[model samples]
Target chain A: TQLLEQSPQFLSIQEGENLTVYCNSSSVFSSLQWYRQEPGEGPVLLVTVVTGGEVKKLKRLTFQFGDARKDSSLHITAAQPGDTGLYLCGGGGSNYKLTFGKGTLLTVNP
Target chain B: EPEVTQTPSHQVTQMGQEVILRCVPISNHLYFYWYRQILGQKVEFLVSFYNNEISEKSEIFDDQFSVERPDGSNFTLKIRSTKLEDSAMYFCASSPIPGYTFGSGTRLTVV
Candidate 1:
């Protein structure tokens, strides 16, 4: 079984702060995706990183895939209240099934 | 943007009762999936359906659980006998490409 382990399960920061969430796994993945979920809602796709050492940016959020494709990271720059939510990283392998990390709960207070 | 939608945002039932959860995925999507997340737990894949048949399933999807795409538009998950442990948030998702588009989800509470 493949598993993605996320670190810093809970983060509380003030507005304008920068934070990074990490997802690591022992198995390599073909692609990795980041998602943000608000209360009472399903996770919404934020970005997907397919190539090794790839980096993608969406507004204030930045996602990076490790060179080995076994890990990924999400960095939020100048986070605001709107950025507060549960962040999840999903790893896709050859089986076509997405294995998700436990997730990081981030709270950016104004 | 196209999205997946689910009905009966919440349902409460007694143990041993049967329940059916419905979902309508993006019209043009070819793959559909069902997932569940227990309170304070990570989301887990229950089953994946493609071409009107189950392509993959997890151990959690036992004899009590089944999935079907009755028509072109609707996908359903039926629980033959609900157990107290079945209480969780059930999410329906669809994929046109790789990443999935997930529905808001249905909260199932089995008493």
Candidate 2:
């Protein structure tokens, strides 16, 4: 089983639409990170949330860490075709490894 | 901006042959890692290295897998004997903290 669970395993939306993807875990973590990946490339770090109940915004992308540090959400405002990619959530797990989610495949139609 | 660099963006090898994947992490970073993603699967950790030694490894990192920081700036992962199932995209990463920078990845195809 995946330690981190992401919902809407696949999301397809039109341009100008908004969407929210979620990550949930039963275990707490010291930090949670979100990454966006395109085909044939490595994942690029989008944001990291260290403190509980903290909210961070990267332009149109908004990220939030739950008060317990066990969940996280990514909200995209006015999605664009460039926003299409794989969104993955990961937490600092044991052995210095990041426990990754199954990921949500988001495809924004232009 | 600094980035982790990986060579041979793609590799095709016969089963039972050995392959060594190379990486040059960002200068001044002390921690290094190897992660791989099988097609349609989430990225999985293979091993982490620090201070010239392995600090952690996953169950998937078995006898056939080994990691070494052969030089001050270069790190490598070797698969002793490749299997058909070993085909995947391997990524190299470096980190100063929880945040990490990853390489574009090397797609390994075992035939």
| Top candidate by DockQ | 2
- Residue B14 in model 2: shift from native, Å? 0.7
- Please write out the lDDT profile of model 2 over residues A19-78, one tens digit for every residue: 999999998988999999999999999999999999999999999999999999999999
Model 2 stretches astray by more than 4 angstroms: none
Task: Assess each prediction's global lDDT (C-alpha) against the native.
Answer: 0.93, 0.93
| DockQ, candidate no. 2 | 0.81
- The residue-level lDDT of candidate 2 at A21 comes to 99
TM-score of 1: 0.98
Scoring only the A-chain of each prediction against the true A-chain gives TM-scores of 0.97, 0.95
What lDDT tens digits, residue by residue, belong to model 2 across residues B3-108?
A: 9999889999999999999999998887899999999998998999988999998899999999998879989999999999999999999998888899999999
How would you encode candidate 1's per-residue C-alpha lDDT over A1-110 as one tens digit per residue? 99999988999999999999999999999999999999889999999899999999999989999999999999999999999999999998644578889899999999
For candidate 2, report its TM-score.
0.97
In candidate 1, stretches whose alpha carbon ends up further than 4 angstroms from where it belongs are none
Top candidate, metric lDDT: 2
Native-interface RMSD of candidate 2: 1.1
Docking quality of model 2: it rates as: high
> Model 2 Cα RMSD, Å?
1.1
Listed per prediction, chain B TM-scores read: 0.98, 0.98
